[model samples]
Structures are given as C-alpha cells and as structure tokens.
Target chain A: MRVVKKAEDRKNEILDAVDELFGQKGFDGTSTNDILEKVGIARGTLYHHFKSKEDIMDALIDRYAVRLIDGAQEVAADKSIPIVERIIRVVMALNLSGGSSEQIMEHIHKPQNALMHQKIQKVIINGVPPILTEIIREGIQQGLFSTPFPYECMEMVVIYASTVFDDDLVVMTEKERSSRIVAFVCNVERLLGAESGSLMDVMGMFGEGDESSRD
Target chain B: MRVVKKAEDRKNEILDAVDELFGQKGFDGTSTNDILEKVGIARGTLYHHFKSKEDIMDALIDRYAVRLIDGAQEVAADKSIPIVERIIRVVMALNLSGGSSEQIMEHIHKPQNALMHQKIQKVIINGVPPILTEIIREGIQQGLFSTPFPYECMEMVVIYASTVFDDDLVVMTEKERSSRIVAFVCNVERLLGAESGSLMDVMGMFGEGDESSRD
Candidate 1:
C-alpha cells in the first residue's frame, strides 16, 4: 500500500530528507536521485514539491530564516529579561547551530555554496535589525540607552558584526579575535550611548565556551 | 616590419582596452575576442599577459584597489587638513567614480558580476581601514579622538559603510539615505569619543551634489 500523506507532511518529508542529504553530502554533492531514493518518493512527487535541488535549498533557507527570526522575536518579547541581557540573548538566538544546523552551516560554508551563504547573510542583514530595534527603543525609554536612529544603529551594528567577524571574510588569530570582540562590545556601547562598561558583559558570550556553560 | 613593445606596456595596453570595453559592454557582455580586437593584439599576446578574461578582470580589480588605496592614503597623510575633514576626504577618495570607474562601478553592480563586486568590497574593507587608522591615531594624539581599538574601530566603520551604503545590498529612499548618514556621523563621533557635531560636516559631503561643488 502506498503511504497516503497530506501534501504539507509530504513536502516536509522531502525537505527533511534533503536537509540531511545536503548536510551529509553538501548541496552540490547531493543529487536529485539521492533525494528521491532517501525520501522513497517518485520523481514526479519531488517535482511537485520542488522544481529542483536549488529550489529545495531555497526552501531550506526560507525555513531557517523563519526559525531564526521567530526565535529572536520570542527572546525580544520576553520582558522578564533585562534589556541588556535580552539584547544579548536575541543576538545569541540568531546563531545557527545545534544538530542539523551545524551540518547546514558546514554545507553553506563550502566555497561552492557561496550563493547560499550570501542568501543567509542577506536574511540576517535585512531581518535582525528590526527585532533588536524594538528592544533598543525600550532601553532608550528606560534611560539606559539613547539614540535617535535605533533601527539604523542596529542595522549598522548587525552589518558590521556579521561581516567583520565572519570567518570566511576575515581570518583572525585567537588574540585578534578576542581584541575584536572587545572593540566590538566597546563600540556597541558607544553606538547605543550606553555607559562605558554597561555592555561589557557581552564579551562573555564571545568567550571560548558554550552559552549554557557561560550561563 | 614587426613593432616591439615592452611586456609591461603591452599588459597595460591590454588592460586599458579591456577597461574601456568592460565599461561600455560590462564584464559579462565583453568577450576575449572583443578584448583582442580592441587591443589590436594577437591572441598569443593577450594570453601571455592574461590567461583568460577572468584573469584580466582580476588584474583590473588589483589596479583599482591600488588606485583607491593610494588616493585615500594621500588624503590621510595630509596634515594640513583637520582630523574630521581629513576623515571625510579619505572616505570620499574611496568612492569609485570618475570616467572609467563610473562605468566599472555600473558593470560590477550588475547581478551576474556579484563575485567581482565581492572582490572590490574585500579590497576596500581590508585596505581602507589601515589607511584611515593612521589618521585616527593622529586624531588621538591631537586630542580630537580616543579609541584603544583604532584599527578595529575603522574596520567596523568601513565594513558597515561599504555594506549598508552598497546599492546592491540595501535600497533606501533619498530621505532614508539622508537620515542614515545623520545617524552614521552621530555614531562615528561616539565610536571615536569625539565631541558631538564635530563630524557633522561629513554630512555635507554626502549631500546630493559633487564634492567639488560642495567645497
């Protein structure tokens, strides 16, 4: 008996299989036949869901963008967290890791998948600033920060951090990386008009340890 | 009778021809045969200088990088200019405009030439910061600015400016662009610990007029 699955479930099954296949074999290495065999789906079904492997990659990117922005929005909405810590948490939430995401990150990091990498960066540059801007506005109201252009300020900060600290873009030694983090935090403090050392705690997040361990 | 030319001169002649051709026809639109015909060089000579059209484009990028950095360095080295004004001039010099450059910019801005755009951005990100850092150090000694991480600070600033203001990356209305400039100048003051309004003059340079007319 053929498995009768809903269209949504069937689409996700294909995506899930492709996601693992992409992670293991990399996007270019994984063939459409590989995806079809892994999902036990006919070529027609696969075509129905995705036009091509690149289409599947685009879908994965969309899913990741949604997951990332939703995670950040959740953190941003949590008022119980202090504004500073909340901002840090929001940034931390944007880090793509854990389980398949690690593999996905590796896949995108491959030189061949530069377009994928650019797409992800484009998502972050366009998406994250507004989420963080809401928190910044609160900080301004609390008299903890001051900026007339909260959105633009965060856009600049996000663009800078994402680009300069990208391992692919600039290679940094341990010493250089640490110093850059220090400078980053310092400049962020200045950008937000926060008191000096107020955002210094952010340095801990960049330390050579897991976020949970730091916590 | 055979005419002889120096290897260096022949390479430049090829480059100069391709530069104009690329400006008129774009990187993708121009071809090897076109370059050969335009330069009036045999295919053998063209291959001697550049293995391929991509190789020629790489050479053009290097030439542009040197021209941009050297121009910025000259402005940065000028002691007669005030620290604030010099910063503006150094940034202004980095703008890729003027005859062939304007066309080069348009060519790189095309979607198909993204890798070329990325390369040019990498040059500016890596090259401009060091040149500006020297000026920032002078500012520190002159009591006009203070930052322990002058190099890192300039890196972040250049990366942000180059990425955000990039026409391909983010689209902004005229009003939005003006406001971003205001915020950028404001934040740069905070980043360098300069007094407020000291960098306001930088805004005039970004207005909707040529730098010479502004002066």
Candidate 2:
C-alpha cells in the first residue's frame, strides 16, 4: 500500500524527527543518517526540504520562535486575567522548560550550541518585548502602571533578565539566584511604576518545585 | 648598540604594536609577521612573550579591564564630586570611545572580532558593578537613592546598557537612541529610588558633539 503525504506534511515530519534527534543526540552529535532512520525518509526527501543540517536547525529555530511568541500573545490577549497576573502569565508562557521542550532546552544549553543559544536570546529580546509591551500599555491605561516609554522599559527589563539569568553568562549559587530573583521583581515594579509588592507574587512563579520556574 | 629592555617593557611594546595593527587591519587581517615586523622582535622573542595571537588578546583584555576599573575607581573615590555626579563620572570612565582607544573600539566592533567583543563585555559586566555599587551605597546613605539591592540594581543597569547600546546587538536611529537614553536615565532613577530628573544631566554626556557620547 502506497501512502502519500503532502510536501508541507513531509517537511514537518522531517522537522519533527530532527527535533527529537537533535534534542537526544544534540545538533553536532546526531548525523543525517540518524534523522533519515528516525523519520523513515529517503536522503533525497530530506535534502529536498532542507539544503543542509544548518538549514534544518534554522527552520527549527523559526518554529520555536513562533511557538514562543504565539503562546505569550495568547496569554497577553486574555482580558479575563488581571493585568498584573496577565503580565506574569505572559512571561511564564515564554519559559521553555518542562515537558517536551526540556530536551530542547538541554540541547541548546550545551556549550557547543552557543549559536543556537544566542539565536533564541535574540528572538526573546526582539519578539517577547512587543507582546509584553501591549500588556504594559493596558496596565498604564488602567492606572495600574505608569510609563511613557513602556516599550523601552520592557526592552531594558527583558535584556537584563535574559542576560543576568543566562547560566552561560553569569553563574550564580542557589542563594544568590533567589536573591537576584527577589531583586529582579522589585526593580521591575519600579520600572513599570507599579506599587511595591504588587508584582512580588510573580516571584512565586520562580520558586522551587514550580514547574514554570525550571528554566 | 643593543638596547636593554625589561621583560615587562618588551611585552608592552609588543601589545602596543598589535593593538594598532588590529585597529587598522582588524584582528583577522593583522598577522603575526606584521606584529613582529612592527615591534622589531624575532619570532623566538615574540613566542617567549606570548604563545599565540589569542594569548596576546587575553593579555590586552586584562590590561584594558585594569585601566577601566582603575580610572573609574579614581573618580569614584573623590569626595569633592557630588554623589550623583560621581556616579555619572564612574560610568563615563568605563567608556572606551575617543583618543587612542578609538581605533581599538573600531577594531572590536568588526563582525569577526565577536569573541573579543564578548570578552570585553564580560569584563564590564563582572568588573564595573562593584565600583558602581559603592557609589550607590553612598547615595543610599545620603537618601539620594534607596535600594535593598544596590549591587543587584547596578548589575541590572550595567547589563542592560551594555547589551542594548551594544552596536552588534540592537541597532537604533539617532532619534531612537536619544529617546532610549532618556528612558534609560528615567528608569535608572526609578531603579535607584532617586528623584525624577536628577540623572538627566547625564544625558549631556551622550549628546551630539560630545566626545563621550561618540560611543
């Protein structure tokens, strides 16, 4: 029996297999043969979809960026959630920890994957701010926050959080990490002009055993 | 007549020559032979002082880090300068723009010299905060600023400014840059719990025709 799949479907199937393979064996460790065997695709089919392993990695990065932004956007658009909680929720949505993404996280964290790590940071620095900014504007309108440079404020905060907490850049002990998180939330309140302690609840999202805080 | 030179003098002469060559031709464009010819040193002497181009770069980065920290410390320790003004000066001392360092700045800004750029950033991130934190602590005592996390606050600000204003990272128009500077000062005031607009004078240091602002 011959089973036919569309080009898009075939492409996605390859990506799906490569994602798992890359996560398991890493981008460098996994060979094209591993991908072919995993996807049950011919060499020609894989080449048809992606010119090279680098191309496949680039495609995977694009998919991850979309997934991350879409998740945050959905949370940002939820009027039902309070503005402050929505802000926290939107940030939480962007965390790539737990479940299937865990392996992906580990893969990118490897020293050999610095380029991939940088690409993800670039995506967050550029993409996440706009999504987070819209929520900030809503907070400003409701008088829950005050800032003329909502977007810039978000940009600064995102840039700081991304760099400081980056395990690759600045390593911290457990005690130091906790203290930094507390300070991060405190300073964030000041940046948005929110009342102190209002955003302290966001700290719970970073607490131990908290699934969202794993990253 | 053979000129007798100390090991430190010989090493510094080599560094000075390579620094100029690197600025003019870039790191990759400049070769060991050029360094040797310019410094008038034999291959054995050059190898004795440094094993490779990368070792020389590491040595240069260490020198830069010390120069930066020492300059900032001098300004920071001066009691004549007001606390707020002192804070601004300490930051300005860390700027690598203008004069002899100008060519060095241009060299590191090239794409191929990203590793060199990253090393400099690491130095700033790790080294600058402690110097600024002492100043912030003074501000806290004088009630000019208030923060439980003075060091953490400075770390956040430094990390943000370094990454955002980093030429290789975020690109902005002149207008956008001006606005971001304003926002940065505003947020810095908020982060430190200082009075609004107190830090606005720092803006002059970043204005057009201002040498310090060239960066």
Candidate 3:
C-alpha cells in the first residue's frame, strides 16, 4: 500500500520544502536532491512538477508574488475597512512578521535570490501604485483626501520613500531617523489633499515601545 | 622614461579603475586583466595596490563608506543650518544622481555585492542616527524638539524610513508614495518639538530633478 499525493498537493509540498531549504542554505547552496529529501518524493514525481532547480525557484517566487498580490487584493475588495487602515494593512501584509513569512523573506533576501529580489521589486513598482490609487480614489470620493493628481502624487511619494528612506540605502542616527519619520508623516496629508499637519498624532506612535499609548 | 606612480597614488588609481570597470561590467563579468588593461598598469602594479580582484572590490567599498560618511559628517559640522534643512541637504548629498554616485550604487547592487549591500546597510544603521541626533539636541537647546527618549525615537524612525520608505524594499503605488511624503513632512515638527507640523512646507518642494546636468 502507498499514499497517492494529488498533483497540486505534491507540488505545494515540494515548494514549501524548497522554500525552507532555500531560506536555510540559499539558492546556490541547495540541490534538487535536498529538496527531494525534504519532501520525500520520488525523482519522477519531482521532475514531473519542476524541470530544474531554477524552475523550482521560479515556482517559489511565483508563489510569493501571488500571495503578496492576493493579500493586497483582498484588502482592496473589502469595503468596510477605512482607507488609511487598509493602506497600513496592505503594507503590513507585505512584511514578514509571523508564521511562514519570516522564512519566505529570509529565502528571498539570500544572495542567490538577486533575480528574485528584483522580480519582487518589479511587482511592487508595477503593481502597488494602482492599488494605492484606488484607495486614494475612495478617499477622494469620501472627502477624506483632496488631491487632483492622486495617482501621480502617490507615484512620486512612493518612489522617493522606497528609494531614499530604505534602511538598506541610507543609515541615520537616532535623531535623524526621528526627524525623517516626523517629516515623512507630515507630508502624507498634503500628498492626499488633506489639511496639512492633520496626521501628527501617530508620527512617533508606531513601534512596540509605544505600547503605553495603545487605546 | 617609465612612469613612476607613487604607491598611495597608484593605490587610489587602481581603486578608481576598479570602480569604473566594475561599474561597467559587474564583478563576475570583469576580469583582473581588464582592470590592468584599463588602468594602463601591470599585473604587478595592480597586485601592489590590492591583493586580488576581491581585494580591489573591498578597497572600493571602503572608499565608498568613507565618502558616504563624509557627506553626513559635513552636515553634522554645520551648526548654523536649520536642522530640517541640514537633513534635506544630507539627503540631497546622497541623491545618487551624479558623479560616482550612480556608478557606485550600481556596482554595489550587483549580484556579487549582496554582502556589500548588507555592509552599506549596517553603515547607515550605525552612522545616520547620530548625525540626526545632533540636530535633535540642537532643536532641544532651542526649545524646538521635546522627546525624553530621543535616541530610541530616532532608532525606530530610521529603521522604518530606511526600510519601509526604501524604494528597494516596498514598491509604492503613486498615491501611496505621495501619502508617505505628506506624512513625513507633517510629522517633522512633532518629532523635533517645534509647533506640531511647522516644517510642513518642505514637502513636495524639496529635492531637485537634478540628473540631466550631472556628468
């Protein structure tokens, strides 16, 4: 007697194993056999789903892209969530704080995942602005935002922020970092056509240290 | 007569040559001979400056680190510039729009430079906060910023801005990007202890499209 794994289920198991191994040993360091060993599948079964190591990596990347887009898409579909909260949730969904997310992020950042990293960036650059545009549109309709070129404004804002404020790009001392956050938050209202200085209540109120203010 | 390049001068020349060649053709693509040929130096001359190709990369990275720190340090020394303006200048210095900035950035982001990228991140984390901290101290002296734990505030702020706002990490929809800029500008006054959102004017007005004139 033997267990017969469905094609989709078996493919997911292989992908999950590959994702974990890639995260642990990096794309270059891992081999097909390692993936096979982790998933305990036959060579035929492995090749049946993926053509090569790179193919597996591609599948893994595709999985991440789908999950990421799906997360944002779900938020976009939900009408009950406030625009600001939805924006935050959408961004937070992109972050890897729980469950398999840490593993996924670690795998993607590995040196061999350079292409994968760039691919993810491409998805972000091409995909994100439109989603945010919709949120901005909703805000505009609800009188929550007042921008004439909501989409263009968001584009410039996103480009500047995604590049310069990236921790990976520029390092700031504590004072500089705080000032930037303050500066960044203050500017958001204007970007959205809201009154200037209207969003200051949450500037420094974002991290775990601010637990005292949770109400 | 044979050219007699001084050791330090030759060392700088080799590093510069490595920077250009590496910029044009990434680490894997450029050979040692290519570096020697372009620099018009012999293999012996190249070795005298650096132990190997990787060594040349290391020297170039060290040079970039120094240049980067120098940019931040210059602003730190100028006590007269308004703190927010100084921060803007510092960001401006890092614009990567001219001279060696673009070359350095491309080279650093090449696949082989993943570790180098991480090194730059560490440098930013270690270096930038204190530079901004000095401004905060000044702001405090002038009764502008009010934070009991300025250091922690700065740390979280830097981590968020550098990471989240980083174009490399999170792609932005145009609307999202604009909102970020607006938020940043509006929050600075709050972070600095000025009247909440006093520095809001800088948003959408700062940073130049200064690339066309650069060589």
Candidate 4:
C-alpha cells in the first residue's frame, strides 16, 4: 500500500529542506530546483505549496519568526522559573546559533537581500517588544521592575539589542562585542530598577564568564 | 573686475541648490537637469564639480557630516559647560530638525532611495560614535560615568538613538514618541552610570519638555 503525507506535513518538510539549503547556500545561491531536488517533490507539488521561491522564503521567515516567538513565549510564561532567570532564559532562547534561523539571518545580511533584511527587522521590531513587554510586566508585578513605561522600556531594549548586537547591522570585534554584552546586561538591570549586579549572570550566555573577567 | 567665485564657493553653491532640490523633490525625483537649472550653472560646470546627481548627494552628505561633527566637537570641547550638560548639548546639536540635514534625511528615507539611506547610515555608524565617545570620555573623567567600555557604550547609544528615534525607520505616534523619549533618557543615564533623572532634561530638546507632561 502507498503511504500518504498530510498537506501541512508536506509543506513543513519543504520548508525544512529550503531552510537548510538557504543556510548553506544562501538565499541567492539556492534556487527553486535545488529546493525541489532536495525535497524530492515534483514541480507541481512544490508549486501547489508555494507560488515561487520568494514565497517559500517568506514562509520560512514566518516559520522562523513563529519559532523564535514561541520559544521566547514559552520561557516567559513558565511560572516555575525565577523571573530573573526567566528573563535571561527568554533572551537566551532567542539567540540564533547554528540554526536555520541563524542561517536565514546570515543570508539576508548580505548586501543583495536588503529587502529581506528589512522584512525580518520589521517582524522583530513589531513582534518582539510585546513578547518582552509581558516579561517586564511580570517583573513589575514581582517587584523586580518599577518602570511606568514597561512597554516602552522593552521597546528601547529590543531595538538596541536587535540592532547593535545584530551581527548583520553592526560589525564589532569579538573583544568589542564582549564588552558591549557586559555593558548591555549592566544597564538592563538598572533599566528595570533591579539591583546593580543582579543580571550580571547573563554574561556567561554571551561567553564571557564572571564579572572579574571583564576588567 | 570679472566675477570669479572660488572653487570651494562654487562647489558650495551647487550643493546648496541640490540640497534644496532634494528636500523638495527627493533624490530620485530630482534630476541632474533640475540641479543644473536650479543652480543656473552650465552642465559643464556642474559636471566639473560632481560627476552625477548621486555624486552631488554624496558630497552633500560629507558636508552635512562635517557640519554635525564640528558642531558636536565645539560643544564637547567647551570647558565652560558642565560635563553632564556638555553631553546633553552635544546630542542636542546633532538633532536633525528643520535644516538641510533633516531634509536630506527625509529624502533619503524614501523607499526608492534605500541605497542613499544605507550610505547615510554608514556615515552615522562610522562617524558619529567617535564624536559622542569623546563626550563620554569627558564624562568618565568628571566622574559622571563609571563604565569601562566608554567607547562601546557610546556606540550602543548612538546606534539605538539613531535608529529608534530616526523618524523614517520606525513610525510612532506622538504619545508613543513621548514615552520613548522618557525611556531613552532613562536608559541612557544608566548606560553611562549617570544618576537616574539627571539626563531627563534632554527631553526638552526633543520638544517634550519635562516628564510631567507625559501622560
């Protein structure tokens, strides 16, 4: 008997294949034929799912955005984790490393795909602050934060982090990057009205372990 | 005596005309012919100074960059102003409002002029940070800032402020903008280790004077 796959599953499989191909070959370097060949899907089946290669890329971006948002939301909503740790965990969860999302970011950062870059930035700028704002509000309830402008505070933080630390936007030496991360966490603690050195633990997430190493 | 304008003076006149044209018609909409007619210069004279319309725009950007850097440098170097006040003053001087710089920024921000927008961003990313870093170093000397990463901190500040507060990058409501200004000043204070509420006065330069006006 012949086996059949669900429509959603087949679509997701195509996205997964394309995601890997994009990460490896970049968006420009990868063609629809490459995606079709990798997925072993007939041209008609691929066309049934996506109108064009750009359409597939758009879907991939949506998938990546959803994945990131879900990961962040999961960490933020977990009542079991300490709020401080949750904050750090939520940020860590959003870190793009060795993933298809990381690959997509790398691909779009290239000069040719500026439109793609802008689209991704729009998603982050609009989608992220609200996700982070929820965590800030939780921190406020827990007496960990005391800002009147919780959403706005998170907006600035998101914009700063999304742009400054965005490898595509601002290039920095590793040492320069490490220092910014330390500075970022220190100011973030103050921004939320938390204790001076409370969030310093996040340094290890960026690979600079311990405060003593900073000096 | 025959009228003989200095090369620099003639260059300035062409730039001034093109600046007005760009402000009025945008970079793409304003043609080289428009510049020639507006400047009342022959095509030969216009070509002598700038190879093309894009070249003129690049030159205008350079001039604007110099003007902003010079303005900020003057404020930063003045010993008469208090160090904290100097930081505020230097930022205020760089504010893009009601000038050729503002017009140029608006023109470049149009969707069709993404290249121009990127070029201007490169100028800011490369140029503005050092000028602001000098003020930050001064702040460190005055005991106003205690951060070890003064230059990097300033880089973060400039990047955040340049993008978040940039009128073109992110569209915001009046109320939204007012709140962001408060959050920005608050975070910047912490970023430099300045006391909370010390830099709140910078809000006035943004025309939102006094935090009390924020609802």
Candidate 5:
C-alpha cells in the first residue's frame, strides 16, 4: 500500500530534510540535488512546491516562526501560572538558540542570506511584541503591572532581550552575562511598576551567581 | 606659486570626494573611474591609497567611528552638564541618521554590503558600551544612579536605543514612536535606580507631545 501524504505534509517533509541538510552542510554547501536525493522527490515536484532553494529557506523560516509563536502562545495562555512567571516562561520558551533555531540563525547570517535575516527579524520584532503585549496587558489588569503603554513596553523588552541574549549579535563574558540578567530584571520590574525586587527570582532561572542587589 | 599638498592632505581630499560621491550615488553606483574623475587623481595614486572600493569604504567607516567617538567623548567630559543630561547628549551626538552619517548607514544596509553592515554593528555593539559606561560611572559617583552593573546597564541601554531609534531596524507609527520615547526614559530611570521622573527631561528633547503618564 502506498502511503499518500497530503500536500502540506509533503511540503513539511521537504522542509525537515532541508533543515537538517542546512544544519549539517550550511546554506551554501547544500545543493538542490542533495535535497532532491534526500527527499526522494522528482525535481518537478520539488520545484512545484518551491521555486528555488532560497524559497525553501523562506518556508523553513516561516515554519520555525510558527513553532516559536505556538510555544510562546501556550505559555501566555496558562492562567494557572502567575503573571510575572508567565512572562518569564514565555521568554524562556522563545529562546531559539540551542537546537534547530541555532542552525536557522547561522543560515540567515550568511552574507548572501541578508534578506532572509531581515525577514526573520521582521517576524520577531513585529510578531513577538503583540504576543508579549497580551501577557503584559493581563498583568496590568491584575495590578501586578501598571502601564498604559503596554505595547511599547513589551517592544522595548523584546528588543533588549533579543539583542542581549542573541549570541550572534553580541558576545558577553560570563560575568557580563550574569550582570546583564540582574540589570534586566531590575528594569523590567520598574517598567511594569511592580514592587522592587518582585522579578528578582528570574535570576535563579538564568543561573546568575551574583544575586546581590545593586545598592 | 603652486600649493604643493602633502600625501596626507591628498588622501583627505580623495576621501572627501568619495564620501560625497558614495552619498550621492551609493557604494555600487559610483565606480573607481568616477572617484578618479571626482578627485582628479591618477589611477596609480588611487590604487596606492586603496586597493579596491571596499578598502575605501573601510577607511570611511574608520573615519566615521573616530568622529562619533570624539563627539561622544566631548559630551562625556563636559562636567558642566548634569549627569542625566550628559547621557542624553551623548546619545544625540551619536545619531547616525543625518548628514554624512546617514549616507554611511544607507551604504552599509545595501544587500551586497552585508559584511560592511556587520563590521559597523560590531563597532556599535562592542565599542559603544564602554564609552557610555564612562558616563554611567560618573552618574554613579554623583549619586545620580545606583547600579552595580554599570557596564551591563550601559550595554542594555545602547542595544535598546540603537535598535528602537535605528530608523532602518524597526518602523513605528508616529504615536508608537512618541510612546517608546516615554517608555525609554521611564525604564532608563529605573535601570539607573534614579528618581521616577529624574530623566523625564529627555522627553522634552524628543518633542514628546503626549506627556500623559502611562497609568
């Protein structure tokens, strides 16, 4: 019996194969023939789904964004979690560095892939802010936070976190990293008008050794 | 009497022409021939100073960095200005979106010049934090700020400002822009552990029309 996959599933299968190939061989090293041979798809079929290799990379980025957004949305929707904890969890869940996300980041940073990098940045910058804003708004209603500029606050937070935590963007020593985590949480507490030290528990999650309050 | 220029003066003259040409015609549009014609230099002299257009661009970036650093240093050294106002002035002096700075930014953002963009970003991410840190340290001594992580705080501040205020990175509606200005000042106060409204004067510089507190 032939296992007939739906068009969407077939498309996803191609993406998964290329994602692995890109990880192993990088964007420039991976050839279309490699993809076709790995996926066992005719050249026409592959072309039917994607115009070119770059198109395939775009699809992979979209797939990655969807997964990230879904993970963040799940944490945002968990009413059982406290509001501040929920925000921290949402941030942790969106850390796209350890696994396939790292590979995607590498691929986009290639000089020829500048456009792809821009597109992914647009997704994170424009898309992630609203999702975080929803959580911030929830905190505002509960009086755990208070800010009429919820959207802008979340935008500022996302921009700061994305840049500081983005290993590709800026490298930091262990001391610098730990210190930043402290500064980050301190400002975040003040940004939301939460009581001082309310968000300091985030340092524990970040494994920051120095927990001394800035006196 | 013929005014004989030294080698250094000739180099500066060529740089001035290429800078204006790159500003008017971009990195790609202006050719070596255009630079030669504009500067009235023989091909040998041009090649003697710069091997390629990219090398010329590197020189230009170096010059830009020096100018920016000098401007920020002057502001940082001026003890007459208040500490909070000094930070704001230093940031304003580093604005890369007007005059020659704007041209350099446009040239770097071109797709073919991704390497140039990365090089410039490296300068900003690594070079900028320490310069801002000096001012932050001054603020700490004056009892205007209370932060143990002064360098990290400055890093965070630069990353946020460079991204949000970078016209190329993120686009905001006019209202969104105004709100971000307010939010930026608000968080900066908290990050430095200054009084709640201590840095609100930055809003006046930014022409923030809507000063309503984000309650």
Candidate 6:
C-alpha cells in the first residue's frame, strides 16, 4: 500500500515538472527525452506515469483549469470580504504571474497553440461568469451594484481585460501603464455599480518584474 | 510624366494587394503567387513594388503604425470634445473593426509576425503618450483636470483601456460588456478630475457595434 502511494506521489511530481517544461519549451520544442533527462528518472518510469507527451499536456491543461476555477471560487465564497476587494482578488488569482500560469500562458501564445488558446479562453469565459455572478449577487443584495445582467457583464469585462491589458498585446512605459490602470479600475467600479474610484488598489498589482530576470 | 505616374500607381496597387492578402492568410500561409493572383499582376510587377515577401510585410507593418498614429492624432486635435469622448475615439481608431486597421491587426497577430506585433506595440507605447498627453494637458489647462502627471496618467488610461476594452481578448455577452464600459468611463472621469457620471456619453460608444450591428 505504501509503495502504491509513493508511486502516485511520483506521478504528480512528474506531471508538475512536465507542465512547467512544456509551458516554457513548447510541445514541439520539448522532447520526451528532455522530460526524462530533467526528471532524471528512467524512461520506463516516465512512460508508466504518462502514456505519451499528449497525455501529459492534457493532464496539465486540465489541472491548470481546475486550479484556476477553484482559486476564483474560494474568493467568491469569502462573503466577509468586501465585493470590490473580492473582485480584485479574483482577477489577481487568474493573473498567473508566477507558478505554472506563466508557463501555460507562454505555451498558449505559441502559433500552433492557437486552438488551445481559444479553448482556454472559452473555459475562462464560461468559468468566470458563475463565480463573478455570485459576488455580483452579493453586491446587489448589499445595494452596492446595479447591474441587470451580472453574468453577461462579467463575460464582457473578462474578455476585454484579459486580451487588451495583456502585456503581450501592447507594451508601454510604466508612467503611461500606471495611468491606464487607474482608467481601467475607474471603469470597473462603474460596471459593478459601485461608487466611482473604487477598486483603485488594482493598479498596484501590476508589478514591475525584476529587470535581472529578463536580461 | 504620365508613364511615370502610372508606374507609381501600379506599385501602390501591388502594395495594397499584398497587405490585404497577407492580412487574411498570414505571413507563412501567403505566397508571392497568391499576391500575383489577387492583384492580377505579373510576377515582375510584384517584385518591382517589393523585393521579397518579407519586404511586403514590413511595408504593411509600417502602414499600420502610421494609420494608428494618424487616428489617435486626429482624436487629440479635437480640443472641444470631452476627455472621455476623446479617449473613446482614440481607442476606436486603434480597433481593427474594418478597413486598413483590420488588415494591420490580423497581420500582426499572425504567429510568424510576433516581431511585428512587438514593434507595433512599442510604437504605440512610445507614440500614444504625446497624443493622450495633449488631451490631459488641455484638460489641465482648462482646469477640468488636476493630475500632476498628465502624460503618465493618460498613458496608463490608454494602455488599460486599449487592452481591457478591446474585443479580441475575451468575448463577453453584451450586457456584461456594456456595464464594463459604463464602469470604465465613470472611473476614468474621476481620475481626470471630472465629476462622477460626467463621462456617461462614452458608454454610448460601446453600443455602437453591439446594438447597431445586431440591429
């Protein structure tokens, strides 16, 4: 029984390693040999955990989707927190700044991964509404929001925010970027029917990456 | 003299054809033969306008950057218009809804054209500020705004709005999207020192494609 448990643990470890590597190197760029080399496990052991590279990618995407949804859900359930704060938290949760999210984004942006990008976007669109809808309901109950269609509103906002504000989409100086943040948050507050100037803190979340990391 | 003018016209026609075809099929999928087919021009004629397929793409990117700047500059010059209204117009000018802008966006988004996308973004970042800055400067001059960093503020507003409000990122239902628009304009008004609700006219722009085209 202990041996079986240990095997499952190793499988998960392998999955995480594969996810990060695949995200960074891309599927075509990465080889099965690279996986084995990085994990330093025998080829047979690697195959035992995942049937093939495709299978591993499938598992990684699934895990990524689930974690993304769960993180947002956790924020949704925390009723004690204010709705505006909750909104920021939910968006920040999906940001994927570090961890496996960066790898996933990098992978999705690759040319061959266009279909994958569309599907993940679909999932985000479908996944976010329900979670945001609940908080919107709370905000309505508290009389902080006045939106008639919460789910639809969330869908539009998410689509716009994710695509346009994406650093990959448009790059600007920090001075200009910060102003854009203020403008964005200003609009978001009104979308939720909150008072103007709410959600200001979101601007701070757009951090400056360590310059050394890039160069 | 007429012969020279006609030759110049032929060259312009070839460049236009390349832009349209490359935008639709992308850099890799498009070929010189395809360009010849579209323009009904001979091989020698195509080469005269552009040295290679790569040259065609570069020229197309250059055209796109110029168009983007021209549109933004047009919006900036209209000092009588409200800041929020001017901002919406600037964003609309950048959108790839139809015409030359659409061609530009499609060309940049192509996988092989990643460098093109980066270049265009860099241009927007560098060039857009002065336009938005002019608006902020006008607002401050009129005592309608009070930001110390007009340029930076407008740059942030432009970047955030351009990305978050952009349709290509995430597709949302109309209701969700509009609420976001209202929210965005409202928040931006505050950032610019305009009274809350003063920027409501900007929300009308969202309804432009959503309600009108559907009708």
Cα lDDT listed for each candidate: 0.77, 0.77, 0.63, 0.70, 0.72, 0.65
Runs in model 5 deviating more than 4 A are: A1-14, A21-54, A96-115, A202-215, B1-60, B96-100, B106-115, B202-215
**lDDT by residue for model 3 over B1-215, one digit each (tens)?**
46897888988888877778777777667899998898887888788767887677667778887887787778768978877667655654543333234445655655444445655655666676777777777777877767654654454345445444543555568677656656554444444455644565443345333433342
Of the true interface contacts, each candidate retains a share of 0.51, 0.49, 0.11, 0.34, 0.60, 0.09
Q: Root-mean-square deviation of each candidate, in angstroms? A: 4.5, 5.3, 7.4, 6.8, 6.6, 7.8
Which runs of model 4 end up more than 4 angstroms from their true locations? A1-64, A95-100, A205-215, B1-64, B96-100, B205-215
Q: How do the residues B63-138 of candidate 2 rate in per-residue lDDT, one tens digit apiece? A: 8778767777788899898888788766655553432334445566554454566677778888889989998998
DockQ of each: 0.50, 0.42, 0.12, 0.32, 0.39, 0.10
Give me candidate 3's TM-score against the actual structure.
Answer: 0.60
What are the per-residue Cα lDDT tens digits for candidate 3 across A1-215? 45688889989999888878877777767888888788887788899988887788778888887777777778777889867666645554554232234445545654455555655655655566678789889988988777666665455445445434432445467676557656655556645656555555433333333333554
Relative to the real complex, the DockQ score for model 1 comes to 0.50
Interface RMSD of 4: 2.1
In Å, residue A33's CA in model 5 sits off its true spot by: 6.8
Q: Would you list the rank order by TM-score, best first?
A: 1, 2, 5, 4, 3, 6
Query: Which residue pairs clash in candidate 1?
Result: none
lDDT of 4: 0.70
Task: Give residue A109's lDDT in candidate 2 (0 to 100).
Answer: 53
Could you list the chain B TM-scores for each candidate?
A: 0.86, 0.87, 0.77, 0.82, 0.81, 0.75
Kindly list the per-residue Cα lDDT of model 5 for residues A1-215, writing each as its tens digit.
33467889989999999988876776667899999899988788899889888899889889878877777787788889887777877776554332334544555555434455555666777778888898888888888887767787777778777766754667778786766777778877776788878788754644433223322
Candidates ranked by lDDT? 1, 2, 5, 4, 6, 3
Model 5 / residue B18 / CA error / Å: 7.6
Error of 4 at B184 (Å): 1.7
lDDT of 6 by residue, B1-215 (tens): 11334766776777788767766776666788998888787788778777887677667667778888987787778868876667666666675253236545655554444445545655676678778787778767877776655664555556545444542444557775666666656655655667666566655655575447776
Model 1 CAPRI quality: medium
Tens-digit lDDT track of model 2 for A90-163? 66555434223344455565544545566676788889899899989989999989988899999987888767
